[model samples]
Target: MAKSDKKPGTRRDILNRLKSNGCSDATTLAEVLGVTPMAIRQHLYDLQSEGLVEARAEPRPVGRPAKLWYLTEAADRYFPDAHAELAVSLIDTIRSSLGENALQALVLERSRHQTVLYRNAMEDAPDLRRKLEALAEIRSREGYMAGVEETAEGLVFVENHCPICAAAKACTGLCAMELQVFADALGPGYDVSRTDHILAGARRCAYHVTERETVDG
Candidate 1:
């Protein structure tokens, strides 16, 4: 058989490569997956019917028109939600196997693990204000409109917007939890206050961190 006529890789391989490339059209995908154009088209159609892919018309010259295929943004829902699902399942299993107290301890342990990860990612600097500024810049690069300010209260890292979670308000709670994690990482006796009014008009809402005064002083 001719080299070009060789059988192609599995459907999963085709789907993975397409996703990795930010969703390419059928012809491009066929080249990547080592498949015939017709086979790619058939798989694309199947994926579309399953709500895993979307197709858009591409403007072309006088020849036959072409449609670009892309993995739907909702495609992440198929695999991405599994981590959260597993977390909940593990908690439930622990509760069933042990008890509520054991489950609570497990939750606390997991919280500490998450806190450590955030802390390691944003370690403390000699200058707290500078540290906050650096962290804000990092957040901005990650798609949040973020900044730091030395307010009357203390060093504040304000997040003006969150691009990713804006569309899903229910997930905003995770953002709030992240702020608390930042505060905890900053250390004991440090106050981290979030202001709802800072980004009142924003689509998802915004947050500000303020250092609290210590009573010992």
Candidate 2:
């Protein structure tokens, strides 16, 4: 939901704000965009009518209930999940024909292939931070809009977008495979586990990565 690929004052801009800031009112949105609250209200109304966003009332004790805007489940389609039409269709057909066990096996095979590709990109990353950075770069290249957060405990790998979300949802095994791939790529020096998943309704995919006993989060 970033504005990098979109111009200011567009629907994308509004959505990006709500995405990063959680639910917000028109005044807050106008202040952020330097626009009139009326203009922001129009945008919010349009988005709400389109079912992309939903507005809620928040009581402030004295004034009218403030209108807070947030994205609807339908808005998830606007995120990074691209290149998925054919992929999901093909996966659906495979699963329908081959059965669940075969699909799981297929996911494992695909994970191994992905692991190799990630390993190549991360092979030279010596430190824990470097490895996290390298993995983020690789994911960004694949349209995940990935980034790293350095905390006192460990490096948090956050992917704000998932380009293959449709495929992953069609087969949750894809998510499991991704966790395994991350662990393998980083080797035994670190433990990698997902704390947030977009499929589980989280805004992003977040991982708690611990390096040895020093970095735990």
Candidate 3:
């Protein structure tokens, strides 16, 4: 039997594309999704009416301008956030009741646990790519929207979204410890360093992984 053609709802797919790749125009979106431009525009109109998307005009080299569509802040409701409000509240309570040192201890403990879990998950993998893929799968299951990609620079681990954004903002130490956790989790010969940080006002978090002759971690 021939394979059936099926796909996600157009609106959801559009939102997801915008979330992953940032702003885009309907023509570009249609091409990527194998749909007609008119269909994409219709969905964009509905999304805009629902306050989930918006568009701004950009100058074109030979034409008037192009309408570039992008997700609005309100669209964040569609993505997983790992109970942001509750996480932030817990972070606040821990800091207020126990103090800074206690919070630091808590963050460190969390990092240690994460490192152990990641290391164990990647232990059976045969190579660096396999290990990174294992790590990506684990993180994706944890709501990070993570994946591993090969680029000109090196192997890159990309987290398109941070589900614990609120909690991380409440305690920056969580962010700091994450770097150490990654370095330790990947083991001795690999060096994992973050090149992009969402907390630092970037769209997402990305880490560069490179094999070194010797690594301190």
Highest TM-score scorer: 3
- TM-score of every candidate relative to the true structure: 0.41, 0.76, 0.88
Instruction: Write down the lDDT that model 3 would get.
Output: 0.88
Alpha carbon lDDT at 29, candidate 1:
73
Ranking by lDDT: 3, 2, 1
lDDT of each: 0.60, 0.83, 0.88
lDDT score of residue 200 within candidate 2: 89
lDDT of 3 by residue, 17-98 (tens): 9888889999898878877788888889989999999999999999889999988879888998889999999889988999
Model 2 spans with C-alpha error above 4 angstroms: 1-9, 24-38, 57-67, 83-85, 150-153, 214-217
Off by over 4 Å in 1: 1-9, 60-65, 73-77, 83-112, 118-169, 176-217
- Greater TM-score among 1 and 2 belongs to 2
Q: Give the range of the ten consecutive residues with the poorest summed lDDT in model 1.
A: 197-206
Model 3 worst lDDT run, 10 consecutive residues? 1-10
